[model samples]
Target: MPELYSMQFLLFLAAVLICYYAAEKLFPRFQWVILLCASLFFYTWAGLPYVVFLLAVSAACYRASHIFAEPGVSAENKKRVMVGVLLLHFLILGLFKYTGLFRRWSGWVIPLGLSYYTFQSVSYLLDTYNGKQEAAGSFWKYLLFLSWFPQLLQGPINRFGAMAPQFFRSRKFDSRLFRKGLMRYGYGVLKKYAVANMLAATVSHIFTQVDGDISGCVVVFGILVYSFQQYTDFSGGIDMVMGVSELFGIEMSENFRQPYFAVSLADFWRRWHISLGAWMKDYVFYPLALSKPMRKWTQHLRRKFGMQWSRSLPAGAANIAVFFLVGLWHGADLHFLVWGLFNGLVIAVSDCMAPLYRKVNLPKKGAGIRLFRTLRTFIIVNIGWYFDAITDVRDSFICLRNTFTRFRASAFAGDILIYQIPYRRENYMIAAVALLIVFVVSLLQERGVDVREGLLKKPAVLRLCLYLFCALLVLMAFPFAAEAGGFMYANF
Candidate 1:
């Protein structure tokens, strides 16, 4: 089985870092060359056949963009060029990644990372056509951006306008940068092994073993634990990626903030998977909002129900459609579509009720108000996450029904404990402790405390001890085998 921290992978990263730092110090102009070579090596390490496909796609888009950018190109011609490039990329993506759906047409194994980089490449082509950014003069720089090792498999889905400038900026290997990067990486390791992994084991055990005979209360507990497991697993992977990028003085986008603290579904989307949300807003919502049909509809609504109703209905409908698309993008499955639509509906319903909510005049400042809002937000977010965790629409419906069934003493009985398949008393204890730590840390961060900085301010011995403890936990707890599990967003 493949391992997350294989010795060969570590050796590869070490060699790349050494060469990268050396190149930065010696021939700064050739740093892009070093990055390109390292990226190719990284991609090849996944599989040599896949590397050929990656290069071919990169070369095709790079050349197509140049054609679109030529002098005196008519507006219609430019549009055609842009559309052609995008379609070609999508076609290649479908050929490799979606071949299973069309197995009779073409039998081919989908390459890893193709879904991620395909979107990145299409975004690059679109941005260049829209005049948001210039096409890279060299193919190598474009290639490096597409296959950057830290973001290849799982992505924050970067755009050229945001990431290209940093790729060109020369980086110097400094002690401060190294220290900060290592700390971030270490923090991610602790979050994954010490917290997320343990929760995963427990959730897996409960979900698999809970029979139809289980009582409502025990099922609710299992669902709650599953919610936390998914959150930490996905967010912990983001931390690892972000931390590794920092090591080379390259910063990727931040994907999550304090999402669970959000008071509304709209606010939750703003804080969670921020990159995907931003992409949908820019590419889908804005265009639809400004389209002629929507504008006419807005005018018609204004005539029928005064100005206020007219102003919101058009944009509100657009948001719902965009979020529906957002869900479909995660997978071809109907369950994912329902999950996305559920969020979109929540946002829509909340918007409709805003005037009533405002009239209720809830206090906004005191500790009591803050505590109430925090708890309310946590409950709502967890319910949404529960829908996301279930296997299908029917299962989600049954789970919800079971949750609301009448409580009973037998629901919490010892037999319920026996039904937890792979779970142990030790696993539960460890997961509970890990969750407490996560909650405390999140609370500190939500209050605007910089956790790493605060830790640094402690006495040297204390700080060292904390660091060592985190390292030991990771080494002891990480599931090292490939069969263990993968980052949640990888399937997307």
Candidate 2:
């Protein structure tokens, strides 16, 4: 079963497509049933052991929300009930996802999709309490939302308001939507299995090589490659999930939007892992901003630090805290924590300098300025990527050192594959071509244009030729060895 993961995914997806269409055509009212059943089966495929826990969590939230909806429940009573529900959900999440880290003696096994579903359940509860969305009248509908197969692994984290109506609506299967969805899914597959996986393999070799034996130059190169590998792997997974959901006539929120082209760290956050950042802002940042402490702090700063300082200071501090939490959310490791804080600091410092940066004399609407800023931002992001790629802080520093220092001719005299890993002409060629393609696509996207749409609008012969070329490139570049590996973000 472990050896056949890819085969299993293909089979599951085929079964889902057939069932979805059949249900839509035959018994429109049973659409939610089909989704729920498909989702359960997807979870069960991971193993039967965790199915009980999944259902239990769903039931807990289902019942708790009903308590909130009861006609005579006092406002205080309702708040208490909702708090209890949130706590129970978090307790289960901690027990399953963080028991090992929290309790050293315990050897608990965390269940699959616990993090993803927990967030979904909590979001639904919060939405219901806030009256932004209604509680699912039926347990099955709620369960389906929690366990939707396409988003079960990693997510765009659909809100109740976003997903519930779609789940209940009857979808008339359309060929164009299916074709576009399939193309998107195929593009993601190529990005992951072909581009990111190949890069991952190379990065793994570099990281495993003896530390000091490799020149700092090689280490720097590895860090840069790892940045691309991580982004492609994560965003590629999101593309696949969104594409799969689109086949069912549901549009998942896009998780990425040409983040590398962002002019500022704040803009990058808006573009990358968009759902997560939005979630933090909606649930965490807003609440913090409106709190008594923050309000008071803002007022104090206004009087003492001047109006400009008051407006920026509170938000800057909050941004730092959010980034710190974001870092800690990735892993228990310090490196991830530092990576999160590093981004937070970037945004905070950028916010402080916004006024001065705007005043700098520069070209406003020229290709030269755009190119320079793009390059500058890319370099800053790559440097930040060191914290994420290297497990050890010292190793990251060493890579930075090697990147800056010029090496002698003797450094290139060794077994190039071990020291200078990307020594092969083919390796350089592939990296260069992959980067060129990504840059072109990003440029198109940044200009508010769709690459696919633009290409399709061309003359028939040109469009066909372009598609055929992409198909051939993907086929030729596919990393067969990594076929069994699921996307990197799937674990998250």
Candidate 3:
């Protein structure tokens, strides 16, 4: 596969862009065919076998979607069909993604973006069955939506309803839109190569050490740096994806929103990975919360414990269930499950404590309280990162215990500060500066300033200089960046 940042990827993108625009000019109504062709070719880069597997998935879902539109089919039968189709595909996902449980042979490959496209396929099935949208009339077009290159890896999981209109409409290229996309893509590349890659080495080094090899202070520092590294890696990739889609006159859902500024666990989730949260809420949480068993549970709690239990407890249970799935979505690993449950329990506890919070607050709307909540939430989120960053379920707890129980500056300096990497000091400086730029940009966005639009208003000479300076910084930083295999979420 062509790496997103590689020279080959640039060449491939250039070819696609040239053809895409030419198609719009000559064959306006069918311009999307160019994109469809590009998508298939891009997926083919992963391997011919993967393409065959993808075809099977797309064909199955495309065929199943028609069952929803079948004349005189009972709703129950449609529901059964949806369940059967979903289970078979999810079972495939499990067999590949969680091979240890199923005893797959050594050296089998998981198809690229299997989990992401699967979710999109399931959403298409559900939406069609519910009469939320008409079934896709063509198999190839539906395949294009699943295989769209920008979202083929980690995705915001675009909905068919949201994507179909933007994709099918004829769109003449706009220079301004293209420039904005180019700028955002540059920003994303800079973030990945300069900031996230720089920190990734030290973060991995610290976590992979035996508990005795590192001090609690170093563990805390590693996890703290990891928080920044993860955000930049993930949101940067999404930025790149959104920017690429924008180049084709397409708009995707915003996946991140200055998640660090969030004031609560629920708020953090709302701001972070917004697409996945929305998906789970729409497809899983709402369904389970509104299900008959949950309704009965709520009524029983209402009789026993008042309205608080009736409302909060049922919703809390659904949240837990949703997050349990969310954890599994990342991987079928124990640590991921723990990470998800940790988040769910915190939210559930907060929900149950809502009345007490309402009564005890001194000044809920105060800036000081707001800042405190944001910091508190940040701390809470970092605690969960232990499970996420560590591979072993037991090691996560060991690291957490060390963090609180064994912290010391002297030991950290001796054990971790002396850690070796190529250009470690220089990489640290570059990462710091790069992170500051990202923070400022995020701050401006938070303040409702469209940074790209603001840049467009500047003289061409000034904007060109800024872009050149960014390029220079990334070139300098990336050469020395260590252990940056690729975007972090691609591991999923």
Candidates' TM-scores? 0.92, 0.90, 0.96
Candidate 2 C-alpha lDDT tens digits along 143-217:
888888888778878787888888888888898788678767766765665567667766776766636445765
Using lDDT, rank the candidates from best to worst: 3, 2, 1
Stretches of candidate 2 exceeding 4 Å from the true structure: 1-5, 101-109, 210-214, 405-416, 419-435, 454-468, 478-484
- Please tell me which model should have the higher lDDT, number 1 or number 3: 3
Pull out the clashing pairs in model 1.
none
Highest lDDT scorer? 3
Full-model lDDT for every candidate: 0.73, 0.74, 0.86
lDDT of 3 by residue, 1-492 (tens): 777888999898989999988888899989999999999888888776778767888888888889888988888998888888888788888888877745456455777888788888888888887888789969988998899989976787889988989888888879999999998889988888888888898777777764554577887888889999999889888888888999998888788999998989999999999988999999999999999998899989999999998989899989999999999888878999999999999999999999998899468787899899999999999999999998887888888888777877776657675555345588888889888999999989988999999999999999989888888879988678767547888735
Error of 1 at 346 (Å): 0.6
lDDT score, candidate 1, position 268? 82
Candidate 1, residues 317-353: lDDT per residue as tens digits? 8988987887767666677778877777777777777
User: Per-residue error at 289 for model 1, in Å?
Assistant: 2.2
Better of 1 and 3 by TM-score: 3
Q: Candidate 1, overall lDDT?
A: 0.73
Residue pairs in steric clash, candidate 3? none
